[model samples]
Target: MSTPPTSSGPQLRSFASTNRFLTEIASPSSLRPGYVLVGDEIFLYDRCRKAVLSTLVPEDFRDFSLHDLDLSETSIFEALDRAQTPSLMAPFQVLFIRNIKNLYGRGSKKEEFAAIEAYFRSPNPQALILFVADHIRIPTDVRRMDYQDKERFDRIRETLGEWCGTVELARVDENDAVRWIADTAESRSVRFDPDAARELADSLGADMMLISSEFEKLLLYVEGKNRVTLGDVETMVLAAKQRSLYELTDAISAKDRPRALALLHGLLNASDGGEDAAIGHLYMLARTFRQMLIILEKNVRDSRAIWQALWQGFRMPPFAAEDLIRQARRYKSRRELTRALRLVARADLELRSSPVNKVLVLERLVLDLCAEPKSSLYEPSMQFAIEM
Candidate 1:
């Protein structure tokens, strides 16, 4: 997906380019006397706060509580009454509604829903009713009704559509993510080397919120630097716990016994305060390897499909899927991987039960599996290793 054009200044030109409704208001067109901003991005709320101050409304519109209108306690009449209120100063006022989806369902008071629908049918021209329902789908009636049947909803969409223009914000894919990170880092006056951007994208995955926060932190940490290097990213952005586990897995896969042992030791040191936490990390790593084996056995050829299966079944972090997909390519066949997985499973049990040093047990298991002949029996020994 294409990344939206980054605005150089504070003003934005289109809401269609962003999921944020408030950011759209910063566009010159949306600042008109009457406009309705709708959507479920938190940025929209911040926009409303700015708009309220600009309009100079009494009682500090910023203080308006989301809970003020109780769907159960407040009647539709009361809501409509509020929607119908005239602007305090300007020719038009905004009627902001947060969590509009809450107005749905049989549990909602009938009157409140009716009032909301009616206001949509004939929205006051002098009052702009902004609805923010982030992530929730628009109600069926609202979606299906013709303009005449749902005049207010139609009008709101039309107004927003016009102001937002033809641009629609698309989700950033891996390629776009790399570019976005680079651009964002540069815009903040922080150096974002190409390699650092790629590493950041791989680690953060598709979670935009986390990516943004990390970008900011990295920028601040590396302030005054001309370049954000891979080492900088490793130091500041990488999750130490996750990094060590991933490194341990890589070392095992590559048959690097010493490195694998070192990583295991690192994990142990990090978890010094709690032995259970260390065990849990090892369990998670074993579980990840087990899943990799399953995907291989299923002969899932498509990376995306494998990713979906992993996410649906195991709830792994999205970013990890790509790495797993890459790792899956190393196995010559599902059988080989399955055998290796069984070895790891045994290592898992040994760490838990065997009197051997947990780290030593894990290191030995890695070595043995990497040394195993490609033709070894697949299921029983593998299962035995895990069970024992």
Candidate 2:
């Protein structure tokens, strides 16, 4: 006799990518299994949820049928039991259960898991249950972690992987981020320049929630405008915390040592400025130099080729590809980029270990990077006509 099919693992699906399981459920005939959205970013998870809900319930019925359950405080047994009841007022109901710790994870009780597994095997036809995994990633001050903590987190993730169906909402990489910015702007009937979009993405770092928040603000700011520019980004998106760091990078890229040092000092003088600020400055500068180096090393010159290289290599948008190419041309060869990276690395170590002034260490590093081997640091009076 043929062996009975055995369990493999979690049937994980991705929202950004195609999932045959989800495709099969597209028709109204199939049963909708619960979902586990795994991601540190909420924007992707929220987007996945909206799509799922739209497919499950029409917009008109959402107000009456959709309900949210806070499982953190509420007992899992009670929540599951409550979700099992069919809605009298609507034909279908969507029960969104937040904080799924009780259902799965280190602290998840065994009895609850058995009950939940039973529910998954035979769920209510009229109700669609959504168990949102509470693994929202937050900033961790301790960059290095003890092995035990890391193992515990891994265990939690493994436990979450047991769900019948899952949607992993991973963070948007550089290229995807620029694409997202452009797409988001287009959707709102606003014009977003590709270069400007890349600049915005780079400036914002990996915080998609903040990126979306800024996107909304920019959309409203440019309400009647035809296009958003790099200047607009510098004016709005990079105005607050990131202003100094980005300005310093611009100065460094423009080969304006004096301006770059000025911005560095300005940042260091601020109340929040100190070792951290200096380290951040070095890190951003290093990143810029690295991108330029990549462009030069690959011999990628054309905008399309640059975009392809950047997207595949660094996840940068094509629009920003042009700017990087131009900057790369300014440096004669890989040696220049090599020297610059070394300078930053050296500064990082000095600031972390040495008793020297933080500001002085960064200033010296900047000078070394800008100085030509045969000439003094790029002349302060020789200004380039480039806009930051």
Q: What is the lDDT, from 0 to 100, of the residue 362 in candidate 2?
A: 78
lDDT of 1 by residue, 204-247 (tens): 66345455667767766787766777666666664534655776
Q: State the local distance difference test value for candidate 2.
A: 0.63
User: Which tens-of-lDDT digit does each residue in 1-388 have in candidate 2?
Assistant: 2111111122321124324334534766754556565445566655555656767778888877887888777887887786688777778887777877555456648787788778877788777776665454422222344455445446555654464455545555656667767866776667899877887777776456666777777766777876887656655764333544555656776789989788777666552545666766666667667777878999988776766556554544323446667767778877767666666776676777865578778778877766775433232321111110
**Candidates' lDDT values, in order?**
0.55, 0.63
Error of 1 at 122 (Å): 7.5
Colliding pairs, model 1 = 40-134, 120-152, 346-385
Q: Please report how far candidate 1 places residue 371 from its true position, in Å.
A: 6.4
Which has the greatest lDDT? 2
lDDT of 1 at 205: 60
lDDT of 2 at 145: 40
Winning candidate number (TM-score): 1
Candidate 1 lands at a TM-score of: 0.56
* Model 2: residue 233 alpha-carbon error in angstroms: 1.2
| Model 1 / residue 373 / CA error / Å | 3.7
* Inter-residue clash pairs, candidate 2: 175-315
